[model samples]
Target: MLTYQSSQDISITPTKGQDKPWLLLLLCCFWLIPGLVGHDPWKPDENVSMAIISYFMRHSDWTVASIAGVPQFSQAPLYFWVATLFVNALSWFGVAAHDAARLSTGFWMAVGLWGVGLAGRELFGRRNGRLSVVILLGCLGLPLWGHHISPAVVLLAGFAWYVYALALALKQPLRAGVLLACVFIVLLTGASWADALFAVLFAIFLFVFPQWRKFSYLITLITAILIAIPIAALWGYSLKANSSELFQTWWRYYAWGPFGGARSFAVGTSVGFLPTLLIWFAWPALPLAAWSVYLFRKELWQPHWQLLISALFFKSLFIMLATQQSEALVLPLLVPLVLLASGGVDELRRGAAAALNWFSLVTLGLAALVIWLIWIGLVTGMPLTLVDYFARFSPADVHWKGWGFVFALLVTLVWGRVLFRKQPLGRRALTNWTSGLTLVIGLLVGLFQTWIDVGKSYRPVAESLSAFMDGKHAQCIDVSTIAKDPTAALVYFTDLALDARPDNECLFVIRQTASKESATPEVLWSGHRLGDQKEIFSLYRR
Candidate 1:
């Protein structure tokens, strides 16, 4: 049941608290763009996403995502579509296509910050909105996901927008247009219909509670449904017309697919990994969110409380039921958790606030120190033990960039100011903590951009294997039983389509083996091993 308060209700009225928009903008700019601009696509999700976008850009299809001409129906088309636009846009400025695609992810992070701030301001005070942005940026997993081009990034933005719209709708039922638009955006941006449908159902459910069932509320809800149908239908109609196979496949995979297995939901529903993982994964927000809920335990029916609880419950349930419990599945919880946590910022005890600040300073300080140590080790080859340890990993193509160091130094100064400045134990403490966190992250990323890129990138692997190609085209080689990462690496690096064959009418066949002895194949082709002993990729040529 929903408890609806009139627009005149003082309990729900927002207070005008101190909000430093410039400070928020600076933090977001730093947090959002670090590890974004110049990194190569990494393994698993990033490379796969990049591959799909590459395909669409080359083929000019906005309605579907494909990899090496094969439709990857597991994901929706929105992310790739948006990234393609960025790819084209950045090309004018001479940025690499894949790198440009990552810029869009940074943009999404900025949008998410705005959405969080807007939502918080509507439901709580301006101070809460500002705190929410910092809390979200401080999320442990955000730095990893926020800088990459993934469906999860779009979903993050869409979730924030949806929540902001929900807050607006609660205050003025006529403002449901914004909520409806947000729902459509979520669906359009690759979220499953379950989420969009949930938004509509939740809106209607809002009206069912209390005296909120006014004509305006009903009209808003109905209008939302009306708007959603045609938009979805239009996309479906275009999709069906463009590629009937894709249209059917999208529904089959998303709508009719089986829910998550026991293994997928085991940690989520079980007590072992999730609790420990969430401690750090959700970070400061998780603690504050719990405290906020405890504070409002008796007021769960109010719009602010009800919206978060309902959304989190359904999303968590979905995750529990999902056939694969993915990190992406947990992304929806980020904003709701932040919203809930925002409610408790003012209520946090002074001692607790001080502890949080100290915790952030120590944690980020140690992390930054470690990054600096590694950079020094890479540059000077100091400490024989450190050099030996690094020797195990591939040597990153390191070069000294003066500007990078200067920027890091500047950020370090800012972090110092935030830590030493005399600020009160309310939002400023939280802001300084998160600001320091973002600064540290930005400094590390700025200084180690190339090192990070080279360490994780597949470009080196592709370059290494190119020698064995003997000046032959990528199509000249056929791949058999190669893992997904290396396979995608070859395709992206070589800019060639791979042939999946046991024996092919090609110059060479690439095979992955466990050890040197097992590397030899029974086939009649001459085998030459290419990759390191860790990941053996043998090239068999006729």
Candidate 2:
């Protein structure tokens, strides 16, 4: 038989030793602040994000988003708009445009962590809220994707807002409705939600869980949709008002993409997405979250547990089964999983606790050591082979920065101090995992930032291409084979008006190929980065 949670049972009272705001703040700073500002826009995500941001900086057009000079219909303007603001705001303070745009991703990520933490508190307990954040910080995939420029992270913040708002809906129906309305607008406006329909349906679906079937909850659900309508319509109206072509393109392509995957799961899921890939992607949190669900098997119908389960089911139904697969799709899973994992920590058995503590120690400890050794190699010339190995990634003029040593040493000392402190194994395990992750990422970024930046940066290659084009006073150039990622990078780095579409009639052509040398006699320029063999771009006369 199911029972309702008593008012007292759900009340949140933070105990002094159980959680501390200062400690949580410190942990967040340690995890988020590193590896954010020290590098150039790396390819895959940052290049495109910065490219879009760069586009906004030069053009007064905010209604239509574009990559280079070509109109891009699918991208949501919200991210570029936000990123552009960050770049402009930070430029007066001496931050570079790319670094400031990247910081926009960090800003969204911080919001996500806050929402997730607060949601955990509302759904589970105050301590669990803090633990949820730690669990999320300890996730394997976060450090990379969370820091890079992508609206997916913004969507993540929206999901966190959704969960947080839903958790609030139980108590404050009207307020929760208004909050959910804002969340709906945010999701609907961004590229994250394919359509606003599912978000609406999902609010209604919550009533299926018996605990939330009351009239107030019904009012909450109704209020959300009613309020959300105007904003979504206004956005649509704005789009159509700006240009019918852009609105039609968005509705046709971007809005319906998620539902289109239902045709066949065989197109990708089982074969392409190995189960272990996501297992490690979610890491220790997944296992703990699963254990928590099973441990409370009898209480699975409880509102908090049921809410998380339903949310997970709702998300995974679309994301996990989608035809397209990227590691980022699994990020939203972390919010609920980490929240669940926090509950699991409360009931953590002695053996499991011991195992978790040792696991964090062994795995992250070893990783930290390896990073330190590599940092040492990069700084001092004792290990010739190792130094020589990393040296090839950057230009010959690039030298190790002294600031790397200072930053790395401070991180190491702090890590060493925390490593010996006594605490519950579960809390200790979470702490060690996040701390070690911070230390490792900190060392890499602080010690080898220039090397990593040089290897991945598009600046060198874009500049080379730009210089040749300038020397020739190039016009009507072609970009037939270039991928969008590099094209965006070229737009950002060179400010080139690469709008001309490709055809045989063009006077100049720019194509990217794996071949090191162009076979054409009309070649004007050919180049790649310092150690890259995969991409070699060439420009030539037709």
Q: State residue 321's C-alpha deviation in candidate 2, in Å.
A: 3.4
State model 2's lDDT. Answer: 0.75
List model 1 lDDT by residue over 1-542, tens digit each: 23222222353234454224576677777677667776788756887887777777777557776544456665557777878899998899999888888888877778788888888877775456777888898888778788776878877888888877767764576675656665665565466665566566666666655645567666766777776677666666788899887676676565422231222212235424345567778887898999889977887767678778777776666556555566776776889888888787776778988888777777778887787777777678777688777655545644456667777777877777766644456555677768767877876777777665656677766776765454455455676567766666666666654665555566666777666544345433222222235565666666
Which stretches of candidate 2 lie above 4 Å from their native place? 1-19, 193-195, 257-274, 395-401, 471-474, 500-505, 518-520
lDDT of 2 at 275: 60
TM-score for predicted model 1 compared with the true structure: 0.87
Count clashing residue pairs in model 2.
0
Candidate 1, residue 111: Cα displacement in angstroms equals: 1.3
Residue-by-residue lDDT tens digits, candidate 2, 1-542: 11222233333334567446786787688777777787778879788777777777877867766774466654456778888999999999999998898788889889899899888878775566787888898888788887787777877787888888888887888888988888888777765345356667777898888778889988887888888778767766887898897777666656544433222213345444636566778877888889888888888877888888888887776675565666766677788888888777756777888888888878888988887777666656757898777667765333355776678778878888888866667677878888888888777766677777778888888888888778554465666568888887887788555753444355777778886884667778887876687889888776
Top candidate (TM-score):
2
Model 1 residue 178 CA deviation in Å: 3.3
**Which pairs clash inside model 2?**
none
- Name the runs in model 1 displaced over 4 angstroms: 1-19, 255-276, 397-400, 466-477, 500-508, 515-533
